[model samples]
Target: MANTSFLQLSPRAQRLLKTTQDFVEQECIPAEAIYFAQMAPIGSTDRWLVVPPIIEQLKAKAKELGLWNLFLPKIYPEGPGLTNLEYALLCEVLGRSFIAPEATNTAAPDTGNMEVLAKYGNQKQKDKWLKPLMEGKIRSAFCMTEPAVASSDATNIRTAISREGDSYVITGRKWWISGAGDPRCKIYLVMGKHHGSKEEPHRQQSVVLVPADTPGITVVRPLPVFGYDDAPHGHCEILFENVRVPAENMILGEGRGFEIIQGRLGPGRIHHCMRAIGMASRALDYHLNRATDPARKTFGKLLHQHGSAAHELALSRIELEQARLMVLKAADTIDLHGPKKAMVEIAMAKVVVPTMALKVMDRAIQAHGAAGVSNDIPLAYMYASMRTLRIADGPDEVHIRQIAQTELKRAAQVKDQLKHKEERERSLRSRL
Candidate 1:
């Protein structure tokens, strides 16, 4: 049976729910061998070349079923008319398999980048970029982090973007640039220092749209997670030296990069957390099944029936539930308040979900003995991905700081309100 917690879709969301569920079971599951083969430690160029056509075919089938573009806000015409709350459920469904998001054209970097353009880009800029992006004709990358700086503190980014005439020249080295290695990747939402005084650090940075084919842009290397380099769509290190683009490429004007991030990262962060939940859930299932298997058991008792293994499995379930509820609460906050207003909840979830997922993965890995960390199971890979997230997006400490400030301010506001009510009661009693 499929997972019941896959998503709770409304009547209108039923189509997307059914479509993605069917696609994962049929196409994505069947492609696991091909997927793993292509991702094998010793890579083959043929395996890499062969998988694209297979992915394209699966994507075409999904598009034909009207499952395309369900990841974006329904406020935009490109996606199914669903709110963030609605899409969070669907993202969980796609999270079941690593390949499912791409099959539906709802993968990361692109999803976040598309939202950035849709929310901030001008008509000409949207026409040149957003349209193709929404159509899934090409993929894109977000170039915000740098190799030399503590990218978690984005204010410290040193990538240089200087203005000259009608153009802006960019120069920097960025690592962990996800989706940049794909053959289909055609654009990059590059964030860097624009022509500005260094005194205003935040204002000094700007976001510009740079074509993947722009001159002087170099793919330095693809970084491996643990030991696997996710080919065709791996995280990459890119070098931009004297790369120039039309000044028209700047999105929502300069110094507003921070403003754009305000709108961009909220959804992206939650989406990653939701998917992490699904991945952990699946890993738990694998561990449970492996433990109980008659052939796999060492003693007469099934692995799941054993004291140590069962304890970890039980803890995994509890942790998974806790993380899910927290993510849902964060999603609700985003729905109730705007993303900016719900910043504390968003940051808390970004910190909490990944930590929970990492723990769940660790337990599952131990259950599998040494094989858990082996490429034979997805546990190792999922763990690596989740671990990076602790430092990626924003670090745990940064989010904790924001959450602390929010709680302090909220407590102070409540205290003041109560004091005012007491004062008003005292005045009324004296008048009486």
Candidate 2:
């Protein structure tokens, strides 16, 4: 779907991709304006309490159209059986419209949480949490990041999870907890350090399923990204004041937190990158539309007719195509090999895709002049969302470091080649 041959996709996935593209263009994009209008104004108490009715209407439509939970990979029996690469093709279409992701129930935190439960959760856990999640009956949050530490290295989280009798008590403060502010967000997949474990730092951590209604849990406020609240599914700052859950909620037993998260984040990161490509494509659309408008002229020439504007727009297109190839390669690699083996590709996509999207959106914004930065067009909001991807999951520096380390593995071999070159040069110099 990333401009690849149709032969690369199964017939079924191809059909789904076509269906999803049409659905987004016809239904999802049209409904976005209404969805925004239906929302309770920002800063209103009802912003969190009341969801847009249009979203439910769209969700019902999406379900009827067979577009629901398409994020679930083929490995899960409960899913429509799309592979990661296949879902990625469709995901870009969904990313074009903000409402599309939620309408189809493929939004973040939930997607990652559902993957975790499906892969690691016990029968009881699956039935209780994963079922409702899969059915779109509830939303969820992943509470791993902490305000007190550099959460990029997940092992640094200071949240305390201690076993006490029949339950485990969790105590810590977490920020940027996406989806925490949603009223429908009923469960939390919380990651914390197990108390008094002498195990290695990575092993001492674990994730537990916490019900949102559990005692001592407080949602302080939603944090904004570049001043956008992203209400209803806000990234929130929450305080867990001795919140407790059953010991049964511990996912895949103790000391396996890193393992579980590593699995969850790899695919999730790819999903985000794919969505970013979609956003970048949409921004380019806005850019072209504004630039080619005959009424909008600079020095008696249309904006696109100007060499500078044409060059910038052309460069944006080239950048998008180049970056998309990398992301598609990463997705295909994930399909062929597991995410663990595709870490280099995934890291490369994670680093490059967001950066690409930002540049593309900036060009689109410049084309629109002042209107682009305002809420007048979606470009500003789109820019903010893409910008966050640089830091979320893993920051650009972290992924760059991973890529560099992989390259550095060849340093010794390069050193030997350098020695050979030196000897060859000496012999040539002596002959001369």
User: Highest lDDT, which number?
Assistant: 2
Report backbone clashes per prediction. Answer: 0, 0
Task: Write one digit per residue (lDDT tens) for candidate 1, span 1-432.
Answer: 234455565777766667777787788868866766554345655422334566777788888988788877766765677877777666777787888888888889888998898889999988999999888898999999898999877888889988889999999999899988887889999989765565477777789999999999999878888877777787899999999999999999977787787688988888888778877777887878787778776666778777988888889888888888778778768778867877877888888888898898898898888999897778888888788889877889988988898788789789999999999999999999
Could you tell me how far off, in angstroms, the CA of residue 331 lies in candidate 2 after the best superposition?
Answer: 0.8
Tens digit per residue, CA lDDT, model 2, 312-385 = 99999999988888878888888798889999999999998999999999999999999999997899999998
| Model 1 TM-score (2 dp) | 0.91
RMSD each, Å: 3.4, 2.0
lDDT of 1 at 318: 88
Question: Candidate 1: misplaced stretches above 4 Å?
Answer: 1-9, 38-51, 195-199, 414-432
What would the TM-scores of all predictions be?
Answer: 0.91, 0.96
